[model samples]
Target chain A: MAADNDTISGYTAAFEGFEASLNGGARSPLHARRREAIAHLQEHGLPTARFEAWRHTNPAPLANGCFPPVVTAGKLSAEAIQPFVVSGIDGPLLVFADGQFVPGLSRVGDLPDGVQVHSLSAADSETAAIITANLAALALGAEHGFAALNTAFVRDGAVVTIHAGCTMDVPVQILHVSTGQAGLTTPRTLVVAAAGSRASVVETFASTTAGAGVLTSSVAEIVVGAGAVVEHARIHLHGADSLHAGTMHVTEEQDARFTAHTFCLAGRILREDVHTVLRGEHIESTLNGLSLPLGDDHVDNYTTIEHVAPDCSSHELYKGVVGGRAHNVFRGKIHVHQAAQRTDAYQSNQNLLMSDDAEINSKPQLEIYADDVKCSHGSTTGQLDPDALFYLQARGVGLQQARGVLTRAFAGELVDRLQHEGLRTHVERLVSARLDAVLADQGGAR
Target chain B: MLKITNLHATVDGTEILKGINLEVAPGEIHAIMGPNGSGKSTLAQVLAGHDAFTVTEGSVRYENEDLLDMAPEDRARKGVFLAFQYPVEIPGVNSAYFLRTGLNEVRKARGEEEIDAYDFLALIREKMALVEMDESFLKRSVNEGFSGGEKKRHEVLQMAVLEPRLAILDETDSGLDIDALRVVAHGVNQLHTPQNSAIVVTHYQRLLEYIVPDFVHVLMDGRIVRSGGKELALQLEDKGYDWIREETAAAAAATQPAGA
Candidate 1:
């Protein structure tokens, strides 16, 4: 039964069909890498909940044929994707529908000098060779099944490269929409921040219909050059029945700075893996996440920060609010190598369970091999205080509004931490909308 | 006015108020004095509709309606209030915003329009003086990181703003120094009127000196053993609760039904 249920067989078949359609040798090494990824999936099926890292998120629905793979994307009108655009960005907005770039629907303004921003599928021969050289360089192995699969089927995604000492004043947004065909959307991104350059990128994912189920497998690889600064934010608002799993691999050179903010509000099953390597001295990395799940949905966040050089620092905080029967999982790991002395790392995860059936599991771990390193990790999970609720109720605020006040307060901490005003406001609005949806669901259930 | 008849309440299945009865008319300040573990705070909590305490047998009537049947928020809307012994700390909720929400909700319940931010600012600024609270307190989180005295004063501030008809102050003076006691008591005195009544629950005589009670009742072992006029407080302060306990016990034993 297990062998029969092996879902990768379906994907293997799809790969053969896809390979036959592509121009021979026109794809070159990327096509070769694609073949290798699908072959691994055939040998070893998709990851199960039994895996230590996949303990909380179960991809069984996809494997069991509940959500089959999508070989072709559905045709969606421009009206379907008008809602997911990030309104504050003026430079460039790359639009993708089920892993295929839609240029007619996208809007690209004038960009700064020495900044190259375009879709990977639109890469020229010389640019394609450069991308092929760097492709799979950051995400190397098939151990991460979703990332490998994403690589195998990556049709189009944002590819950005900034010249040395250049800075972009405006943000570049990459918007991906899964139009609810019960299929798959794989969008792979690569960003190279040249030395002494500064840039910011925002990625958003969502589906058109409210409860339509789909599978989205995405991977993003980033390289921060020496003395460069890069800020990245990923906001996922997939439908409640969809499954979203993405991996991010970032490597920082000496004296570079990198900050990543992840916001997940919708999805039946959502999991994010973030890995950052501090390779040189004076490198700093920040990872912040906010997740609010409703009903029986599940949201999982896993982050790992490895310090490979002396005088490096990392700070991470992940907060969650689980309403109804939702479940939330967060695990953060900080590893300091033997030669990475003077390393400073701190991690904290706080969660609030809004209903009796809600569940939150948090684990913060530190593995330090250096004697002079300072590593601290803490995790807390608790329900909203009854006393606080009563205090509000006693003053004439109704029970429901009081609950909303407390819930908003719990999410406000994360919303306020966003240093970018536009991003903060955008995220705050999403939080409010999410809370309203949760309240509506609860009201209906009650 | 408020009336309690044959009141019996419990916490965690343990009886706390055993067949206690009390009444307060308009313009009256009734004091409930008892030693530790005498259920003084429990009574205050029960009157305010705290769900932790179960009313095994009792009826509480206010304005000729059954007060015990109402929810906590409903009771608040009906002009019933309790100044908590330890005011809860709710972080990230601005004090001014919370206060306005409370006032506006009560107004909405009474068919009154909500107060605008401009009017609310002026109203809260005027009420802040009653409790001797700084204008800065209005911007901070509700009672978060507040000093003990500030929390108590904030309660008085709420009472002043809500203008409850039946206010129950539970241990409001337990942790206050003399100056804070005077400020809080002064605020209470300023808000008192012939149209409203109050029930003051305390352990010491110092608070009674400022907010004088019209009647004093002594509670022991979950029952009110004695009731009297204002002199009762002075007498209890000098003699303590032992004499009252002994007198009640003797009377109970002497009146015991003929058994065996």
Candidate 2:
């Protein structure tokens, strides 16, 4: 209890200093929101194992760590971020180092009419107006500790808006690279897709080094307007010793179509929560995720799809490949309100444990108030099928190669879901390379 | 090319193959006919190096090497193949990719250069023709959602692609429609050569009519009670297995000591 209080007080003191650093912007509504968040932390403290949501995923390492906010942005070159950027997309590129946008390392091509992309920390007056109105609105009311923490320490992020009837042919890439420094970084992103607009956004969170002990708390709020189509992909490639807690809140109006893909590949301890609400009728939501956790890494994913209007549909599939002694947790909830009749929601989670010590906990919750709803969820966790392995071996494939082939196939199922050819190939190659390393470490199908 | 002496195996501590003896020479097709639980599939599985059965007492010499001492993959690399009785469904593994990987591995083990995708595709097109399989199957998952006949045909297709020295067909005709059985048997016959041998395990004489074997053996009580030419299969088909069971019983009684 004393240790917990010490950590909370540490954040409180950091917030006081953070507020003072805002200078002329200290009394702004955004800063006021930040203050409210810190006070909430002071009153609530950090979430612990006692919290039902944090039962499977422990937060002591992230909550009690000495991860002070990063005082200065890290210097990076264009070459440093070139490998992480999604190619074959002509849209704008936004690169952020230590939560601050690096303009020299980013490129914004000719924007389509009605499409605007800006850095939150250096937004124009017009962009700032939009940011101020939508910034912590969707995330904070969830009463999540990490969301609150992100709001409290938030500074620089990406702000994108697609006006009515505009369609962005290419996806916008928002790349956040950590320098593996020993400090905390908060990245906040807000995207507003107006009515009848279509856009795709890819967000990547990565580290420059493999095992740096940095802590990152990020929040992204997406407001999908009526009849809009928005596709989002969040890829995490943090270092082995880093801690990451990210939340993405999305709200869909009538006839909106939204799809989100999450790829969790690295991090010592990582948690991602994606909550979406269907506010009107005939909305469609899809969430797909894949996580490959090796070594002693821990990853937790939580998702909620709230159907508030009738005739809304949602589909979710999250798969995990756990190697070494890694652990993974997946909790998916589908809530249909009383007025949300004829809701169709489907959820499935599949996990493959490569090592005997690897573990996975998957829970699917469906709460429906309307009777005329179709909801189904299923989860399966198992090792490589011995029969399948033997069948491959009998075809003259070596045992190691057989395991590699099967494991890749299991993980590739989700990679193939990506419609973007370049991103899919990039992700596939990375996943295949990672699986190869992990399989080699396991000493070829031991 | 193969010899089994006093072969005995057990599954879960219950003996399945009891003192079975068989031999196969190159270019010969030997058909083993038997009733249910007569150790036909057991022999096939043991020869293919399935780990489910424990070889209790046996010396299996394949091309002058100890067959039991090698792993399943090693056996396969040594030109041994078994058409499975129940083909496994491997979801998410493309059939073409699986076949290519399998062929490359076999080629690698034999110190042969791996075939590139183009050449492999050409080769696969020819083999698929042998089994009358459509090109779309190459894009589908391996044996997933395949019909019973399609699965059996796929096994034969693999046999054509791998081109093993010793091919053991375990109930390859089961669950296959008449036309599918004819197509599969025809594919197997086309793949057979004077340098390779096949041990066809079956319960009926119908498949024997298509791929006529040189030798036919009747297995009962885990032992070969009778052996003859292909005409023996016809005799069993006419008289059924009851006559063989009765004859074996009488012979066993005669072997007992008088007034023991």
Candidate 3:
């Protein structure tokens, strides 16, 4: 663990300069909020490995670098974004370069009557007020440094508002590509699904070929209204050298259904946080995450589900495939409040350690204040079954390829659960290709 | 098709097979009857190249080629198959996929092009039906969640698909009931031909009734104490293994050299 002071010093200095420049421009209503958020980071600094939650994934590399914000946004054409787009979906596509939106590459066709989509800075005055009121509502500003920093610089991600009784047939895709040199980006997405409405959202984060290692700290806040259904998937496709810390916070109302899927496919250092609050009865909340880390990657996932009302249910399944010297951590907590009677929660964490040196630490905690609640949690960590491997090899599948098939099957369950067709196939191909690369690198096949 | 001479093997520093001799000609069904822990399964495993058993001193020849030199997979590719006493359940590997891969491996070793998915599906459906298995078995994980009988049937299904020249059945009828045993025996019988032979290792004579052996041998203390015609199994089943054990002991005592 690196010293927290040294970790945040570089960013703190750059942030001061950036703050001064923003002050010189026309003062905005968010100036105070941004200042307060940066002040919060200055007080707490970055979380070191000394912090229990940060024990497995050290945030030093992310905070130590002096990654100035994006300046002089690069040109993005349809050709450049074509490779990242999910084909067969004709819904809205929002493209962001380094935290700022690129109008030339974005396409928002005819939307339903009551749906509105806009970049944070470009949102109408009424939507701007809504965004401001909900900004950082899910994440407390003082607990995390990267989150506070993201809050301090939250300006140009996506703001989607679905009016009541509107159910979208197509999913909204948000693509954020970091290009040119190593820098820092803060992508803030706020989705508001009004009462009786439903929508699906997919957020993908990646880096361009010319782009060096970029450190990204992104925050997504989702609001699920009563009788609404919202499905969201966060895909991390950053380069092997990049660092990412993502946080998703959701709040569900009465009879609302919320499902969240997080894929940590690539990155040198990755950490994900998903927290959902169920405040109404008959609410169904599901959280799923699949992480495949190779080489010296460190991946961490932390999830929390708060049941504040009666008759709510939650389910969580998180799995990780760790290769080489990669290390993974999983911490899930299901807290049922006293008034949340008849709450049902199930949590399971499974890990596959492909290499001898790979490590996984999983901790599932449940705290129920109501005696009427039912909850269970279990975790398992081990290598691929030896008998299973021998069975395949005995039947003539090479040791290397056999490992590929079993590995695919281990993670394929999650891939098959993807409700979207194009996204499911895309992820399936990506995971297959990545498994091939990892197996090929093994050489001796153990 | 197969020959074993002066076979001495051990597992984990514990010797099991002291000395054994067996031979089988093409088109012959040889049954090796033995009591529990008589090294019946060890011989089958050693012949299949299982890493757990070490051949301390022995020679196994298949068509005049040393069988010990090949790996388990290489042995399979070279027309050798062993139906395990306990079929291992491999989760995440579909039964059809595993079967096709095995068949393709043998085909590839013979310099044949790999079969496509459609052909594999057709071939597996046909072979599975021969074993009395429904089509749903194709999608299941290899032996996972399958009954004991189903696993044995699955093994025979693989045999029908691979069509190995030397098939070793190691206690294949242990957990199977009468109907499953009959189905499995029938499937094995259907695949048997003049160019292929099977060595059936069993503790019960009931299995021998379905697939009558051309010859039966009683194995004791890891050695074949008596070699005879098919009536040997019936005699052992009727009179129990104690008579054979005492007879072998007396025969050994009479052959012992003076004091030294």
Candidate 4:
């Protein structure tokens, strides 16, 4: 037992050391926050399987390892970032490689009046003040250890603020590319759409190689002020051997509208936790997610929508497909506070298991304290219907092609929900490639 | 083109098809008429290689090939089509895409080059006209939310497109109205060639009148007890299956002594 205790303490100390190296001697108020966060994490320590959010998704792989902090050696070229740009959106671009900001690869053209796009490290005094005021306001008491660790190691993340009543014509794209020598990388982001302001933002995380054993911990904070409409999308396309842990914290004020789409593909083990708080009345939030995990990959999505005020509405839908020995977990909770009368909340999670050995765990929960609220939650997990398969086969389609048709249909439902045509099509192509890989493996097995 | 001898099948330990025999030749349309639970649908499913039915005894031959030994898809590739009584709804697969996949797969299995998209579109358009199906049917998901008539028409469209050597219409006219039945039968008739054949499995003779079968077989207790030239279907329609059941029992008693 003493040996076990010493090994655990040693791992925690190594994690602390890793957090300190992310600062890299950078001097700023954000760095001060990082110092405070590290101390806080040290006191609380990493969460274990006892935590409800971390129960089904074990973090032992992350907690027990030693990883070096990644730093930007140089700016990634434009050509390297062009393929990731969301089509049909012309706005300022910010690029990050290996968790560090690269200004040379970014484009900050003439922006609309009262709109600012700058990194936390390069922000002026007033801008920094604005960021400091709301940087980690919504990330309080993050029970999940990875979120707390990301908060503590916050180095260079985007800080966008749109002034009241300002409307940006184009969305801002923040592309984070991980190019490292097989190790862990933690990326952080903070976005704010002020009162009565409207904007769209797209965040993308991708890897350059098939480096195994890589880890990426990301945190995105979104603040939708009163009467504001903000659309945010996050895409995760890491290497097959990479582990991803991401948290999205959203706070919606009165009469605010917030919409988010999360796409997770090609990760070894991924756990995404999304928490949205309706702070004021008449606020609306929509959350949509799609994930595909193949081979020995494991993907978990945990989301919580809290209704703290009266007359708020929220809708959530998440779908997943798992093949091979892959395992997927979906846990969604919608909580309605006593003061939140007339709250309307809905959530659903659907999963398809392609192989007998593949597994999926889904739990949709609703806790309501208000009497006048409407809330509903549903979840389903099942294998392909043999009758449906035979029906397609009788039409002359081979067994493999029939399976592909059904699997694509399962993915097409979520793809149709994407608002952007180009992104939808692009994601569909990725889904196709993933299915092709599954079929190829099946062929190899035979 | 098709032959079944002493066909015996079971489901869930219960025998459904027992010692059934039938034969179909090229350019001929045969109707198997029977009451509910008379194994009408079982014969179609067994011939199409449905996994639910276990062929405990006997054999099925299509074009002199051992049909029972082939996979369901292989049977389809060998030009055997089963128009489902209850068409399965594939929610995400478009009708056009599903048909094209089926067509190309069959062509490839036959050592033929796959048809290009343009040629496929043209072929589908021509078949869709035979059923009077709307152009939007091609874009909609397969059989999902389709009306009874539309699903039947879609089935006929598949038959016309595949041009199978032997097609089995399994209660294809169950839910269709008069006009839809005419369209379905017209599509089947137009696809009939000297080298192709059909087996219409139906409960009523109304569909047989439209499709015009050359022969009729009365199936009861999983065997063909009576065979005639189209008049058997009309007799079963007019006098009902009770008369045939009585005659079958009497004939069996006469052939096999009670104490043997």
Q: What is the C-alpha lDDT of each candidate?
A: 0.85, 0.89, 0.84, 0.82
What digit string (tens of lDDT, one per residue) describes model 4 on residues B1-260?
88888999999889999999888889999999888998999999999888999999999988999999999999999999999999999988899888988998889889999999999989988999999999899999999999999999999999998889899999999988999999999999998888889999999999988888999998888888888988888888789989888988888789996789
DockQ preference between candidates 2 and 4, better one: 2
DockQ of candidate model 4: 0.73
TM-score of chain B of 1: 0.98
Error of 2 at B164 (Å): 1.2
Lowest-lDDT window of 10 residues in candidate 1 chain B? B251-260
Task: Give the winner by lDDT: 1 or 4.
Answer: 1
* Candidate ordering by TM-score (highest first): 2, 3, 4, 1
Task: Give residue B33's lDDT in candidate 2 (0 to 100).
Answer: 95
lDDT of 3 by residue, A347-368 (tens): 9999988877777989998999
Residue A51, candidate 4: Cα error in Å is 1.3
Q: How high is the lDDT of residue A233 in model 3?
A: 85
Model 2 segments more than 4 A misplaced: A139-143, A440-446
Estimate the TM-score of every prediction: 0.90, 0.97, 0.93, 0.91
lDDT of 3 at B77: 83
Ranking by DockQ: 2, 4, 1, 3
TM-score of 4: 0.91
Give TM-score values for chain A, per-prediction.
0.93, 0.96, 0.93, 0.90
Residue pairs with clashing backbones, model 3: none
Root-mean-square deviation per candidate = 3.3, 2.0, 2.9, 3.2
